[model samples]
Target: MKSTVETLSPTRVRLAIEVPFVELEPSLKKAYREIAQQVQIPGFRRGRVPAAVIDQRVGRAAVINEAVQEAIPAQILAAVREHDVKMLGRPELETFPELEDGQPLKFTAEIDVRPEIALPDLSTLEISVDELQIADSEIDEQVKGLQERFATLKTVERPAQDGDYVQIDLAATVDGEEVPGGSATNISHEVGSKQLLPGLDEVLVSMSAGDANTFTSQLVGGDFAGRDADVSVSVRTVKEKQLPALDDEFAQLASEFDTLEELRNDLRERVTRVKKVEQLYAARDKALAELVRIADVPAPEGVVREEVDHRKQAMADQLERIGASLDEYLAAEEKTEEQIDTELAEAATEGVKIQLLLDTLADAEDVQVSDDEFGHEIMHRAQRAGVQPQQYYDQLVRAGNAGAVFGDVRRGKALALVMDRIKITDAAGNELNMDDLRGGSAEHDHDHDH
Candidate 1:
């Protein structure tokens, strides 16, 4: 057996292979055995049929076809490995082998390959991240958020106001007829929250209990989606949230802290930690951006086009599930289809560039994803998806995406590697030490949920 490669492009190759007829003898024998077990014969049992009998009954063409089917993939893999090509997707058979008795079999396979990339020097790259500073207002906001969580709702005998909760019955009619599935009773809604329907907040506020009003708005979903409907709301109850005073008693009830001062201090520290985490994320992102900006990585058109198509299909699927069309989506987003397409193309190009860069870096740095890392990533994804780890793992395996997961983990580590070598400065012009932020680990300890 022999193989040679033809460079069709930087990201594609064609392989020509020649295998001696004797090399396929084993595959031919196995094919014969398989056919024998499938065909019924007069004097021979299923497993006892001879190769000659199979050839005579099934014909030489059937045997050759089966053998080639079993042999081509293995032969292509061997050729790819021998040529050290980082193949992508499946190989396309450009030429099929013709089997002649005692003659060598020949064929050609065309495949997409990962393009070679030259990585930039990591030390030369510098990025700036936002300084970690917790403002007093931010801390106050956090405290207020905690207070809201512990607040109690009290029924009020006054008109509904912004930030108040209201219980109301809602009904909708189109063209003087009540729309199907367009009414609900005693639905709780926040007065200023427009989440239920357009222009609902304005009508709900300034209305006291037992007061009703109708407003015309476009229904965005359900059976009457995209149609104008008269929405009527009758307030059953109005309630205002009563927050406890920020005193020691309230602090003790809300948290483990014994005093309000202590609780405020803890909240400040928590906000500070969150800011630091943001800076870490910014650093990682900026590091990758700088690396790609400096590296001469070429994007493979096939991969980029495939990614773009997948993204489009995913968006279409999501919109379909929500009973929305592309025009509805564009209108909601306040953008045109042409703008979205341009943005998707740009994003896809950048995505491919970063992937190629990271993969090259992973190879150069000899980055390896340990079994522990892979399992941890799967568990993290499962937790996010609200599923069991084994279930998620099985799904990935069945979808043949397990390798993609491993590749993502490896690329994350590779980016983390570049993060370690690059220099980062805060807005204050102070050199930031990421080691303290990373718990003294140069590499990120968390798994990437790709």
Candidate 2:
């Protein structure tokens, strides 16, 4: 076999491949044998049919077509490897010739290839990160949240208010007919939560126990979705929370801390640590954005368009699942169709650029994902998805996406390598170290999914 590559563009190539007739003899013979066993001959047994009789029945062209179909994939892979082509997706067969008894077989395949990326010097990149500052008010808010979790609900003989829990009976009718699945009794709802209906909270706030009110609002779900309906609610009871006093006894009951002061100090420290982690994330994002800007690498138009189409289709599917159309979603978000298209296109282009850049970096740095790293990623994803690690791994294998998991880990490591080399400064002009935040691991790394 012999192959030559034609440079169609920086990100695409055409391969002209030629295989000697002798090289195809094995496939041709196998095809003939397989076809002979399938076709019937009057005087011969199934497996004993001769090639001449099979050829006379089925014609030589049928045998050649079978052989070519069996041979093209292997030959294309060989051509790719020989020419050192870093192909992106599957190859498109442009030309395939019918076999001549004494002539060589030739074909041409066109494919997208990775572009040559010239990376900027990592040491020269600089980015500013937000200074870590945990205000006293934020700590106070955290303590309040903790308090709310431990607070007990107390029954109060008063009108329902925001943040108060209430029990109510709800019924709705559309055009003087009851709506299916639109009535319930003793439903518990938080006043002013705005989770049930658009005008529910406003009506509930002034109603006391045994007080009933009927309001007209557009139903957002169920059989009456997008239709105006009269909803009636009767408050059965109203309850308010009674928080325990912030004292040593309360501290002991709420947490392991024995003193209230100790709990506040611990909460402050925890808040500070979380803020510092956020700062680290900000720094990583800025560094990556800078790398994308400076690399200026071109993205293949075909790949970008593919990503865009996938995203658009995904959005359409989600909308359909919610019983809404694309036009309705756009109207709700206050966006025009053209604006959505522009946003998707820009996001897709940047996504492709990021992938291409990180892949090049991974090659340059010789980044490798170890077994432990890959397992850690799988476990993390499984935990998020609420599945067992073995189950998730099996799913990936069945879908033939295990290789994609490895690539994600590799790209993450590559980005982490670049982050380590770049300099990060805080608003206070203090030089922060990536090792201090990530403990010399790629756990802080980020990658584009596409």
Top candidate, metric TM-score: 2
Predicted candidate 1 versus true structure: per-residue lDDT over 1-450, tens digit per residue: 799999998888999999888999988988988998899999999878998888788898789889888989999999999989898767888866777767778999888888877787889888898777777888789889989999989999999999999999999999988998889999899888777888899998799999999998898766777899998889999999899898999899999999999999998877676667677778887777777777766677777778889889989999999878998789889999999988988888888888888888899989999999899889988987799999999999999999998998898888778878988889998887776666422223454322
lDDT of 1: 0.85
Q: Which 10 residues in a row give candidate 1 its minimum summed lDDT?
A: 441-450
lDDT of 2 at 10: 89
Q: TM-score of each candidate?
A: 0.83, 0.84
Model 1: per-residue Cα lDDT at residue 295: 73
Of candidate 2, the 10-residue stretch with the lowest lDDT total is 439-448
Candidate 1 Cα misplacement greater than 4 A, ranges? 20-22, 29-63, 94-106, 247-249, 305-331, 334-348, 369-371, 378-402, 439-450
Candidates' C-alpha lDDT: 0.85, 0.86
In model 1, the clashing pairs are none
